[model samples]
Target: GTQSLHTNGMDEALALPTEKAVEIALRTQQIIANESGVADTVDPLGGSYYIESLTDAIEQQASEYLAKIDKLGGALHAVEQGFIQREIQDAAYKTQRAIERNEQIVVGVNQYQTDESIKPELLRVDEQVRIDQMAALQNLRAERDNDMVQAILGRIEQAAHIPNAPLMPLFVEAVEAYATLGEICDTLRGVFGEYVPESWV
Candidate 1:
């Protein structure tokens, strides 16, 4: 069963969605949920030949990719060795080449020639948002048990080094103790180090 949904705005590639874009995205989900009769039944298109074939094809491709990752010792190992980064880089490069060569038609970006440039309106967060958040964080640190935070953080660091150690509980404890994301990530960074991708460009 579906639990949650996120509908991306049309202008998401350019910038954060403007208010109008957000409204449209939300309305799309709302219409699907409220107006569309498809939501009345489960797997409405499941019996269709084309849909079943497409789903099977998607599953097959996904399984192949998962098998490749398993051979590379799972996701974390592959990422550490830069396999994922290189794959992403290769895919992006291929897409860009296609777009540039007219093999891919990207409307205004590639195929259409416009006499004037048109920029979409983008959503802008207020500068005070960061200031307010920092103030809240400072207040949280001033109030919560820092000793507990440090002790739990130490446990987290230790657990991270162990092979296949469960860490979600420690993370929950850290968050409950008001440990900032930066502090927790810094501990992991000290253990796993950062993944700096080799530029293919």
Candidate 2:
């Protein structure tokens, strides 16, 4: 769930600088693929003293945290109690303060400032593209088997009422039936309801 949320947010951010964003992402992935050395052999960094020590320390720290979480009844319990969010917020504040104080040297932000004269061309999402996507949705509905799609969707709605029913299969069927993403999400919203966050103090 967190990964999906992360991907969605990052996708929007990447779209802000579409071309350069994609290029940077691709290059980072390429460097990790080439230099990670996981494929060459088993236990690649097996004997490195610093790495081994660091691994042990991390494992111990994680185990301690997990034990504390379990004592309080696990990750869900920690979140419900606001401990996880508070801890994260504290860490983030510390990091932000450090960066502001120049204790953290973030290369582009702090260390290497540049004022170039030439302006770069930016990507823009055309209003026509949105209209075209809407038209595609309408075309799909016009061509697909409406009766079969309705039956499938009715079954999906019924399945949501039953406990422990994995919705993945139903989702795949919907996708295969050329169901619009918005339609599927609307059905889910009907079942689970929308999230309405409380105003922060």
Best by lDDT: 1
lDDT of each: 0.91, 0.76
Question: Among these predicted structures, which one has the highest TM-score?
Answer: 1
TM-score of each: 0.76, 0.74
Model 1 scores what on Cα lDDT?
Answer: 0.91
Q: How many backbone clashes does candidate 1 have?
A: 0
Q: What lDDT score is found at residue 150 in candidate 2? A: 79
Compose the digit string of candidate 1's lDDT tens values, residues 1-201.
355778999899888888899899999999989998867887777679998898889999999999999999999998877888889989999999999999999998897779797778778899999999999989999999999999999999999999999999999999999999999999999999996766544
User: Model 2 residue 176 lDDT?
Assistant: 89
**Displacement of the residue 176 alpha carbon in candidate 2, Å:** 2.6
Pairs that collide, model 1: none
Residue 156's C-alpha lDDT in candidate 1?
99
Candidate 2 residue runs with Cα over 4 Å from true position: 1-17, 28-44, 115-121, 197-201
Native-to-model Cα distance after best TM-score fit, residue 12 in candidate 1, in Å: 2.7
